[model samples]
Target: MSFILGFAGSNSSTSINYKLVRYTATLIKDPQVRLMDMAHCPFPMYSEDYEKENGFSNSLIEFKNDLQISKGIIISVNEHNGNPSAYFKNLIDWLSRLDRNFIKDKKVLLMATSGGKRGAIGSLEVAEKMLSRFGADITGTFSLPNFFDNFDIDKGILDDELAVEHANALKEFLAKITV
Candidate 1:
């Protein structure tokens, strides 16, 4: 029984990215999924001073524990200026201090969503590259552009074709990783 962690980068209480991540996680079969929220991590801005003073917070320790034991990860990052949100990036920085290869050799499903043409654009690419440098084995990548129009709360993915496409992509990604 493989365990997977699912989370979005944003801390917004009603984050669409979080909702999408949760929905996507349900598409995977035979995996125990643990959904997480960035807000609960409660990490301050990434600074050497803060890190030295505070060390890894309890929530960060808990988050890392979950990752260390999981078989794979499902992450959906929210973009801020064509990059990872400050909150998520900060968390990653802190995790790296604990272990340089924090995500090394771990299977990863990387995704991002936004209301722009690029749909979190270069952020996903950048993250994949950086994480891979630390040995992250990214199995698949998904980007949802113009999220506001493409997805909705009541109906989920509004476009049938797009929905099928994303579902197939996510399923394929999970299949490659699980057993």
Candidate 2:
């Protein structure tokens, strides 16, 4: 069976993106899901000096291992100030230090959720650009705009129509990539 690494790119204790990522992972029918928290594996900010001085954090190395072993990834970003959250960028930077092409040949499901109208569009585009350059095989993308109003825990996706659309899109993409 394929295994998917699912993560949200925020460290907030009550992150809506985390909720959305988890929800998206659960929608996968065949693959086993392993949910990871960036908060649990925080790494120091990336710098060449830091890399030469301290080496990669053990946690960051382990996170890299997880990515290396996974068949696919489901990642949701939480944007701050129209960019990646500090926690997310730190992880990305640390991972890149191990290999400039950390995501080389990896399949990724890019997703984002936000409280505003754009749904973390800035961070989503930024991640797409960076990860693609690193050789990520982007399978699909999703965005939940105005997250608080669009999604409800009790009701699942508040917009059932949109939820079906997103779920179908994800399923199709995952199918294409897994083969």
Candidate 3:
């Protein structure tokens, strides 16, 4: 069956961004959602020597295959010092090496959440810029500020206003990625 791939730009075992991805996946219907964790499918540091000596690992190849089959992607990025975390950035570096245009022509629904008020917006902006270089189109975005205050593990987005906004963003993303 056709599916959309959802993942968080985080390798942390307790990443809030991953929680957001899981919640978002539940909101999507029709095209099934496949959730992946960066922590689970690990990648070594990207380097010319590594690429030449090892080529693409089986795990990387499998990830690329999944991306190719995906109707779209949902990524909830995590911020570190106002940018994407080192682990996620490294993964992208290796992914680009595997196929410079692996994400090309894919529609993306970008989201981020953090403990702080900015809600990892800096990383979201950086990711948007970088993904554009790979030819991925960001069709919609949402950032949840003060994640703990506004979100509940079981109930999802807590505030009515934010819930409506999230729903709207999902609607926009669905319009672009699905027939």
Candidate 4:
């Protein structure tokens, strides 16, 4: 079975982005979904000096390996000051160093969620533009706004309009990867 790697950009234990990604993964019927927690793949702050002083961390290597094996990816990013969360950026930096094309042309379904009405659009846009250069075949995108009111930990998306939008995006994503 083809595996799809899913992860949230935030490391928060109760991150809404995490919940969104998990819910998004459930929409894909065929692929075997593997949810990853950034907290588990810890790495020191990435810097050229740090890399020279200490070799690549094992966790970083394993993360890259996961990307290598997966047929597709689902990433739900968290925004901080109109940018991707620091932890997620750090992870990407390290992985980029290992291989600039770490995504390796795999289809990606990019998503984001936030408490504000903008739904972390800034970070999602940045990822869509940037990740493509690094070999991500971005198949689709989705955003969830006012996450607390629209989504439940147990029930998933509560808003019908938002749910339809999300479902359409997932359908497009599945078509791209499965074809």
Candidate achieving the largest TM-score: 3
- Against the hidden true structure, what lDDT does model 1 obtain? 0.82
| Worst 10-residue lDDT window, candidate 3 | 37-46
The CA root-mean-square deviation of candidate 1, after full C-alpha superposition on the true structure, stands at: 1.6
Q: What would the per-residue lDDT of candidate 2 be over residues 53-153, giving only the tens digit for each residue?
A: 99877777777888888888889998989998888888787788787767788889898989998989899999888788879988888888889999987
Find the candidate with the highest lDDT and give its number: 3
- The sequence of per-residue lDDT tens digits that candidate 3 reaches over residues 1-179 is 88999999999999999999999999987689999987787788889998899898998889988987899999999999999998889888988888999899999999999999999999999999988899998998899989999999899999899899889988988888876
RMSD of each: 1.6, 1.5, 0.9, 1.1
Model 3, runs deviating above 4 Å: none
Where model 1 places Cα greater than 4 Å from the true spot, the runs are none
What would the per-residue lDDT of candidate 4 be over residues 1-179, giving only the tens digit for each residue? 57989999998888889889988877777878999976566678898999999979887888898898888899999999999989888888888999888996889999999999999999999878878879899988999999988999888999999999999988888888778
- Reference-based TM-score, model 2: 0.93
For model 1 the local lDDT of residue 26 reads 69
Residue-wise lDDT of candidate 1 within 1-179, one digit each (tens)?
A: 55889999889888778988988876676677889976565778888888888787778777888887888898888888888888877878888987887787888888888988788968888788877888888888888888999988767777787788778777767777765
Better-scoring candidate (TM-score), 1 or 4? 4
Between which residue pairs do clashes occur in model 4? none
TM-score of 3: 0.97
lDDT of each: 0.82, 0.83, 0.91, 0.89
Q: Which portions of model 2 show Cα errors greater than 4 Å?
A: none
Worst 10 residues of 1 by lDDT: 170-179
- As a whole number from 0 to 100, the lDDT of residue 174 in candidate 4 is 84
